[model samples]
Target: MDHWDEVRMFLAVAEGGTVRAAAEALKVNHATIIRGVGRLEEKLNTKLFEKLATGYRLTDAGSDIVELAGQMATASSQIEARIFGRDQDVSGPLRFTLPISFATDLLMPTLTAFRANYPDIALEILSSGSVVNLGNREADVALRVVVGGASPPENLYGTELCEFHMGFYIARDLACSRSLTPAWLLGANEAVPTDWAPDAGIKMASVPIRFAEMRSQLEAVRAGMGISALPCFLGDADPLLARVPGGPVTHIGDIWLLTHGDTRRTKRVRLLCDDIRSAMQGFAGRLAGRFEGGASEFL
Candidate 1:
């Protein structure tokens, strides 16, 4: 097999941690990925990954090779962008990674408008909280919400879109009752706050449901399951929900639009960046949660 094809398979397995996932990404069968990895390992005379019950775990050799492979991928992407993507008429598929909540709640409507404005550009949206590797071409651009002090990778160029605040919210009907300790509906892996104890006059009942996705959390809040900290844009806009009184902003994060430094200047990338900036400006007030009392100060 050619070195490029073998190396591509190896890198996919390393990143995906499973042959099945690599197959899906490459649009090939699982056996093909498995064979490719085996052949590559035989050629190198080294065990690339350690098979485990959970999934494939990379060995030291695999990790070392993956870094080199990633560099190669980045270089290839840069060359392609420079050579074939220079046309002023932008037309191609662009992949963007972002948190699911941001995509579904705030960005989806604007993206439809973007498509209307630029009919030639096709969008592929990848939603995840885990950071995507733009350098590896996993995504061309990213919309990230990071904590106030967190820094993005140096290789990324970013435009700050807005700052957003999170606060406790509950169903509007449940807003009037301070006597009852509402059942908590938590985000996935989230622990109920210890401060929500009887001593604090905010004790919670048993939490029966928790969701990893923000949309599910919002639905639970609207159903009066319990109070949760929601982004002000989502909470304020929902007619069925209301901000829980007396809770200050629970979290603050800045939303950033980011692209790899190498691709930032590509014509298509540049055009999309400008489009996103303009769309974000239209939502600046809502993105910053300006509708909530005193929330504008945080923005």
Candidate 2:
């Protein structure tokens, strides 16, 4: 039995509390995990865990081992990074995270172009609203929307990508009615379309026809439910949805690219960032309308 592998199994068991959970994390069989733990105990000549009906609990010695194991894991990761970092070619998996809406719209096409340019680089993208932890190695890069100037950790680097443009949109049928003014659109009598708009002021006044996700919100609008405030990308893509003629345009947020300071210097990361920055230049018109004036101030 490999001592390091056994140590890793032991650490996983300690962190996960159950052999079943550890096995799942390690992508190994349950019996394999149990055997690994047994071998680790035999090598150390001490019982590290107390088996229970539900799971396992660490002994006094196990607690000490867990801390050491954590350090070892960190060291191993650092070594692996260093080894990969030495290669001049941009190879290996690059984990990226971004907001779900942005991923589907702004970043997807650009990412496709990047992959075409660098076939050697494997990309793993996680489209989620939840922020990923860079320090913990959860993601190599992240894109976020910030209302104010963002201050990432000193060990991390960030660059402003673009400003997100937003405005009220309604179905062509609703626009034809000529009663879709900002005051009336979200009024008590008017039907509110479910988008990311805040439920205050006009939003509070109206009765929401449906509260839904991005795709559904656009669908609802196309179905002529009501008016909704949406990002420019979504509105521009749909011919059925028309931007309110003269309404309060909002600056939903600024898009930023964030990466660990150490990773920023890497060729793969630098290349990808440069590509994204270059692609975002085409969105100047949309960004300008959102930021050049007090667009988001109404909210």
Candidate 3:
């Protein structure tokens, strides 16, 4: 049996979660997929998956195999690229992952220009709230918002993109009708203020509405549900929401461009990173507010 072919079948089954799905993805018959899996299990002398009514489920051993298989696939792709000199065209699949909100509000607008400049490069944007594993090569690049003293993995390389200032924003009507006092806006929790400024002396008459996502928080504020502290890039763009006067200002977070340390020097990786950094720098005013600070530290 061909080991590589068996490995590919294992990966397909692991990804698709069923022999039928794997067969479809591989453009082979289901029997072929089942035989491939059986051959792999016979060679390894261990059951990778358990047959179930719903679908095949990976055993603990299978889970471990999947992780290793993903890494192997990445290495294989890199080897193929090297042999073919695929990087010479600067146009190919560029998979990237970023925070959902950042991708929608910040990056989506400027992606057209990036594509135009490098028409050969096909961009794949994965907007996930969860952190992607760089070591596994889940994504070629990632954009992360980090706080002070945070360190990335030793296998990862990161560059400071920009800093965003945060402040409270409320609907125009809410600002007008309510006292708009910090004390009234902030409820009992001073550690994290809701609609009012954390430092504001006014006490809240009732609990302000809370939202888990930034986009929802912004929407709630727009709907006049309550005030919310948001980054300038997202908040300032909305016409209905206004940055409250005399509001306490805070550091939202620093945006960083990240890639695997080993792949950072790769031609495609470096070019994409440079292009994204340049785009972020150009939009510094709109996204991060006007802050006077050198690129040395988190502003």
Best by TM-score: 1
Worst 10 residues of 3 by lDDT: 290-299
Worst ten in a row by lDDT for model 2: 290-299
lDDT of each: 0.74, 0.70, 0.70
Output the number of the lDDT-best candidate. 1
Segments of candidate 3 deviating more than 4 angstroms: 1-86, 179-191, 194-205, 291-299
Off by over 4 Å in 1: 1-85, 177-181, 194-203, 206-209, 292-299
Model 2: how large is the Cα RMSD against the reference? 12.4
lDDT of 2 by residue, 1-299 (tens): 24877898899999999998996676555777888889889998999999999899999999987998998888877886887568558877888888787778767899998899899899898998678998788888887777655444434567766777767776765556545533223322334443445333333334354443566666676777766666776775666776665455677677777787457667788788787677666765655453232222222
Clashing pairs in 1: none
Better of 1 and 3 by TM-score: 1
- Ordering by TM-score: 1, 3, 2
TM-score of each: 0.64, 0.57, 0.59
Tens digit per residue, CA lDDT, model 3, 96-130: 88888777887776676777878878888889877
Candidate 2 off by > 4 Å: 1-85, 177-205, 210-212, 288-299
Clashes of 1: 0
Give residue 167's lDDT in candidate 1 (0 to 100): 69
Q: Count the backbone clashes (under 3 Å) in each candidate.
A: 0, 0, 7
